[model samples]
Target: MNKELITDITKYQEFYPPNSLKAINNVLKWKNSEEELQGTIEALTFIVNQTLMKIIPEGRIVFCTMLERLDGRFVLLDEIQGVLNLNNNQMGKNIDELKNMG
Candidate 1:
């Protein structure tokens, strides 16, 4: 039995415990969720802001951000570059800088 006041408004208490970060099956109906997704977003933002900032300065980093659409296809969101000292456009090529240098 759902404890929700409205049919589409799902209260996440059924799925998540207090302060829980686990998504479980909640991701399937992610867009329909009212509040829990916001909490997860905040948690992700906190992680990116707090932890990634510390690690990025240690090396040249390239990463991709992707979004999964409702039709189950993933779309490229953006490419993240962290402190790459080169001024060359090398997209979509896997260049092993260490091997190339040696």
Candidate 2:
């Protein structure tokens, strides 16, 4: 049987050169046997889903760090962060004043 090749192209943006039309398009063509269609569908599905997904991640900032040394030299850093975290505006003003004093 002479098989007819059918195709489905999609509109999808990808990282490419500014003048590249291939950046926003993917070509999926069905050819030969039915077995090959599975691979084509999977490829097309992946490309379509990837293009639809949010490129930029949405997440909360995780603050988890230990700042204490065995000798206790940088122990004040955590304490200062705690105070500044509680009142940043007031602490920022106080820090400015302290800097001007020197």
Taken over the whole model, the C-alpha lDDT of each candidate is 0.36, 0.35
How many clashing residue pairs, candidate 1?
Answer: 0
Ten-residue segment with the worst summed lDDT in candidate 2?
56-65
lDDT of 2 by residue, 21-60 (tens): 2323334332334445545556666785675332211100
C-alpha lDDT (0 to 100) for residue 25 of candidate 1: 32
Pairs of residues at least 3 apart in sequence or in different chains that clash in candidate 1: none
- Each model's TM-score? 0.31, 0.23
For residues 1-102, could you state the per-residue lDDT of candidate 1 as single tens digits? 121211221222133323543465365644535476557767777876675444321132222111111267544443223223324344212233322332
Best prediction by TM-score: 1
Q: Highest lDDT, which number?
A: 1
Question: Clash pairs of candidate 2?
Answer: none
